[model samples]
Target: MPLVALVVAALAIGFEQLIQWKYGPMGIIAFIALTIGLKAKNTAISGLGAIILVMLLAQSN
Candidate 1:
């Protein structure tokens, strides 16, 4: 679980960089791949939840 979380975190950071580079769709693709590859429901859910939170926070700001 911890390893999965760490990998997800790394991927998330990479996705964020991809988004910053204007490859937003690729970021989503990467996210989906990460989620599916991990094969952990909690990891996938937390990853999506974090993405949502970041999007919401960015929109609000």
Candidate 2:
């Protein structure tokens, strides 16, 4: 259930980026939701990693 939400949130972020939408802090919230849903230390860490990767790419412009 939570993993599903996480994926949805991630996809949403991706779409927003595709359309050049600017959302401040929403990505952090999504990452938090994903971490909680993951319920594993390693998963949470990886989720953060993925979020950072996305954020970096988003800010590259």
Candidate 3:
């Protein structure tokens, strides 16, 4: 499931890049993806998603 995790993580990153921000739907999706990944026992997915999510939230006003 590492591959799947990577894919999901990639999608989150793509969404962040697509919207050019992570404060809206992009952030929400990333968080959801993280939750799903962790729940599925894919630490890689959770790690990657958390990194992006943290970055996004940290930068938020």
> Which candidate do you rate higher for TM-score, 1 or 3?
3
State the lDDT of candidate 2 residue by residue for 1-53, as single tens digits: 99999999999678656534444455555555555656665676667756764
Reference-based TM-score of each model:
0.36, 0.34, 0.55
Q: Which lDDT tens digits does candidate 3 get at residues 1-61?
A: 9999999999967865664453777677677778788899999888877887888878875
Global lDDT of model 1: 0.63
lDDT of all the models against the reference?
0.63, 0.63, 0.77
Query: Model 2 Cα displacement at 4 (Å)?
Result: 0.1
What is the clash count for each candidate, in the order shown? 0, 0, 0
lDDT of 3 at 25: 73
**Candidate 1 to truth, TM:** 0.36
By TM-score, the candidates rank as 3, 1, 2
Please give the lDDT score at residue 26 for candidate 1.
Answer: 44
